[model samples]
Target chain A: MVEHMGAQFLLSMTTGIFIGGAAGYLGSLMLSKRMALVAGPLGHLTLPGIALALLYGFNVSLGAFPFVILGIILIWLFEIRTKLPMEALTAIVFSSGVAVAFLFLPIEQAETALVGDISRVNLWEAFVSVIVTSIVFLVLKKMYSGMVLISISEDLAKSEGMDVRKYNLIYLVLIAIIVALGVKMVGGLLTAALVAIPAAAARNISTKLAHYSFGATIIGAMSSFIGILFAEISKFSAGPLIILTNTGIFLISLVFKNRGRR
Target chain B: MTNDFVLKVKNLTVRIDSQNIIENLSFQVKSGDVITILGPNGAGKTVLFRTLLGLLPHEGEIEWKSGIKLGYVPQRLPFIKDIPLSVNDFFKLKKSSERETKEILDSVGFRENLKKKKIGDLSSGQFQRILIAWALIRNPHVLLFDEPTTGIDISGEETVYSLLARLKQERNLTMLLITHDLSVVYKFSTDVICLNKHLVCYGPPRKVLTMESLRQLFGEEVKFYQHRHG
Candidate 1:
């Protein structure tokens, strides 16, 4: 029994690290853009999809993906066609998603959708997780500077020859991708914490841009590794433990925060 | 079609919803000209700049000679004021080498020690310097500035204008700037475009904007609007 559990956790830990690291790296930019809270609504928007996955007994992330993609497209379109900001558009779209979710949510298996279960993955699932996480990270790394410039000044970014709207569409799509993959490691409810806490912690202690971005990845990976290990040792849920471990890192980061900063 | 003509605008109109922000606006720019755009607040000064940069959907032509690089210093960014972005990181985003970034910052009169300071922490004068530095990093044939010295101290404001003049002399860079101060128009501008949604006046600064015109402009709502916007 112990041997079986160890094998299962090896795959869990492997997949969890990449997802957490990718989420953390993306979160670094989102935090800088002041759109970190947006993931909570985006996550909530995945509930209808998660409910569909639960009812059909399919993989949960698969169910969550379509809803999130749709919601991001709506937010992206609304942002372009109207003058409303991303936060307002996201709230308007996702609250409706959450409402639609409860209309059909299966009461019996809702726990799996609400608080994620990482231990149940097979080898194929682990491989897919690793590959998707890798692609997401590379794409993000390529456009990181362009996105940063946009955050500082959109007109400046445009004058520098960046297609601001194209970059923004890519940004929204990447968030949808990560949120979908993240739903497996931490459920829809906790996805925001998964993305935000590590990046917030990195912000406190880092004085440079590169340091803040890369450090968030390391912290995210470390949190997932420890949380999964502890979850195995005791019988608590992985979502809360991972988020708790990340929260601990955030608290400790306060002590070492550059004293000159607020 | 002349190579000397850097920009040609033919009846540009920008409409959002039902209202026309800028209507039937036409102008031209020549190479190496320091054109000042003077207007009361909400006279579509910013909208004109955006239209020139091709950042807005508009009706009519905004023609820039092909392959002319453009740099812009916008009026304000209320969002970035609280974001914790350090000076070095901001330059790094422009892909400047460490030495290159240092040299540019020094040229703009920003000290080396302040490199570690978050841009949010900088005073308005310092932040204005940083914006100017960022715009200059990549050499551009044309620059569009919206109230470039609005927040700087009066003494610092003169220095900023002098630096722009120096760049204009050295590089022959074409500059178009919007200013609230009438004195700026008289002191530095080669040509002036006085705008109140449409072209109010257009000619050499001293030629078209004389004391009589200045008094007329200041006598009306333009005076009230300038103070409130400033």
Candidate 2:
């Protein structure tokens, strides 16, 4: 099975596991904070950068970084200055990002930029994805308790002498980096599905935070692997297939959750 | 500046969107004093507490005697039921050990084996008690409560107040409480501060909680009932 598929397919699969697992883990924190709704907009915000990168023949992930970081900063500043809810701030910033992308990107490359073509992934992109994913996972592990405490109550976290603002900024930066890395393989439109669906599925079956996080990672990795395999065999787009796989897992978990209640 | 004063606020002002929520407020909190703040809705009680805790950006001096730890029990725990957190998991935020958690829960008179129970499953009184236990685990030099008994019943309110009074005596802890209930103001407080955006009066409950001040803080429609206790 390994030898039959070409190097590009294998590299894409490897990238998928690392990115998917990391997204799943971070997604659980986002869900707990009631910030999951921002994930979609943040993902879409990467399009302008990817479009500019393709136009200029630079690394798409590298190009996506500046825009995503800017978006995160804008959202953070607006949240603080206006005291607006994060979802609202994200919507405002993301709509502008979409408008910007349409301004620069040609019609021919728009579909590929929107849905992604993982089969075109090269060795270096795969390697960068693995490294970035590892860093994301490690940072999230160290900050897990602090993040959960903040989500529980910012006032409580503040009383404990924890810098809630610093942690919040770090969390947004991590999400931006992950979105940048994922946009190349999953496409800007579908990147949030990688972050959100597995976590939603995991929450259905999990009774503890630790279990929830671990379950999300497993579900994410499984979906990415299976989706990539099926897409290769059927000549279908890998991004939507992966999301569909995650949705299927969520439905199955919901059934189990309802049974447990009984 | 003296050791007897646990906290001193000098001309503290908090302005949000060009509106002054707390303006030119100054007070000194002595060690081992139970100071309760009485105010009507939107009187900036919560904002004052947040300013003192350094949670909000404010203009003025809020000086705590060096190294005095502060604990806070918010008006209510927000969205505890919406999250799937257990009591034990909630305690773990403090990084307390299992033994410490059990001891704190026992101190708050929660005798059930509720460590594994979801926080949302607990009754309002139980949840409020858990918040108290959480604050106690820190062994704070001063504890702050913002409308601690808001959702509790009348009987449960008595229990919570009595428990707080007992804890204060046992631990020799200074307390700052925000409340609208006059009974709580008279019964538990060593000092009362009547506030409506600024300090109306501050002194012993009998001196400061007069009908004239109540009318000024609340409206002319306000009625005062003095409780007689043996």
Candidate 3:
């Protein structure tokens, strides 16, 4: 299989797994907190960054980083100031990002920018993905219980002496990082699906948090690997294919959910 | 300063968006006392509770005896029904052992088999009991209940109150409870605090829950229900 696939395809597959697993794990937390819908807007918010990066001839992830961080900060601040739900704040930020993106990006680069073309991934991008993914996993592992407790009830977590605001900020930063890294491979439009779908599927079948997280990671990695392979064979874009694979998994998990209910 | 005092709040005020939700509230909680807070809707009952727990920002002195362990049961768990969280998993948030979880559940009258059942599937009474069990597992010195029996039936409410009373006696735990029902106040509270933004009155249920105070707190629309004294 290694001999058959080109080097770029192999690198893309590896990058996809790392990004997908991290996204899936983070997605589980977001889903548990009912902030899953926020992922889509955050993903879309990466567009201006990618556009700026394209215009400036810099790394797409680097360009997306500031905007993603800005988006997180704005969302957090607006949530505190306006007391609006995260979904609403995300909508406001995402629309602004889209409007800004259209100003800088050439129309020709829009397709690849909207839906990522992972064949352009280099060795540096692959290495960065691995490093960032490892950091995300470690932080998530340490914060998992505390985050879950906060999700259950902020007052309960506070009673236990956990700093809920600090953890929430950390969580948003993690999401910002993941969205920045993911937009190049999954595209801004479909990146949130990479985060959300696996977790959605995992929760349908999992009875415990550990199982849900592990199931999400497995499904995500598998989808990325298989989706990349299928795209290579079918001459289709890998980003949309990966999302389609995750959607399929989500649909299948609903069966397990319904069965368990009965 | 008494050795029996578990919590002390003096001139506590909580303001949000320049509006005071709780103003100049002062109260003391003694060990082994079930302090029931009574108020009408939007009377800042929940705000006061949150302030006492240090969940909300407030001014003035709010002190807990150093190193005192506290357990809390909110009026409702804010979980969506679609999530696949089981009762066992809910307990796992506290990192409780299986035996401990089982013991707590049994103590709260929840069957061990229900551990594997989804938390969303539990009835209102069962969920309330589970919340109680969640608190019990902590071995807290002070337990707080914010309308614990809100959605439960009348008989179920009685059962919950009885359970709370038995637990209070057995554990010698200090309790702070928020309730709308005067019957619960009459039956379970050792002290009652009538609140509408500020403290209306505070003392033993017999002295503080008189018609005038009730009228003052809830206004002319309030209806008083009499129950045989517990």
lDDT of 2 at A5: 60
Q: Pick the winner on TM-score between candidates 1 and 2.
A: 2
* Candidate 2: tens digits of C-alpha lDDT, residues B1-230: 56699999999899978899988899889999999998888889999998889888999899998989988998876755535677898898889889999998988888648888778778888888898889888688999988753578777777888999989988899999998778888888889988889998889998877778878888853653333321
- Candidate 1 clashes between residue pairs 3 or more apart in a chain or in different chains: none
**lDDT by residue for model 3 (A1-262), tens:** 5764588888999998888888898888888888787777877888998998888777888888887787777776776778887767767777887888999899888876788877668889899889999899899989987888888888888977888889998998998888888788788888788888999999999886678889988998899888888988999988889899999999999999899989
TM-score of each: 0.91, 0.91, 0.94
Give per-residue CA lDDT, model 1, range B11-41, as digits (tens). Answer: 9899877789888988889998889998777
2 or 3, greater by DockQ: 3
Candidate 2 residues A42-125, lDDT tens each? 778888998998898777778788877877777667767788877787677668777888998987988767877677777888
Q: Is candidate 2 or candidate 3 better by TM-score?
A: 3
**How high is the DockQ of candidate 3?**
0.59
Ten contiguous residues minimizing lDDT sum, candidate 3 chain B: B221-230
DockQ of each: 0.49, 0.50, 0.59
For each candidate, the alpha-carbon lDDT, in order, equals 0.83, 0.84, 0.85
The regions of model 3 sitting more than 4 angstroms off are A1-5, A84-91, B80-82, B148-150, B224-230
- The most accurate candidate by lDDT is 3
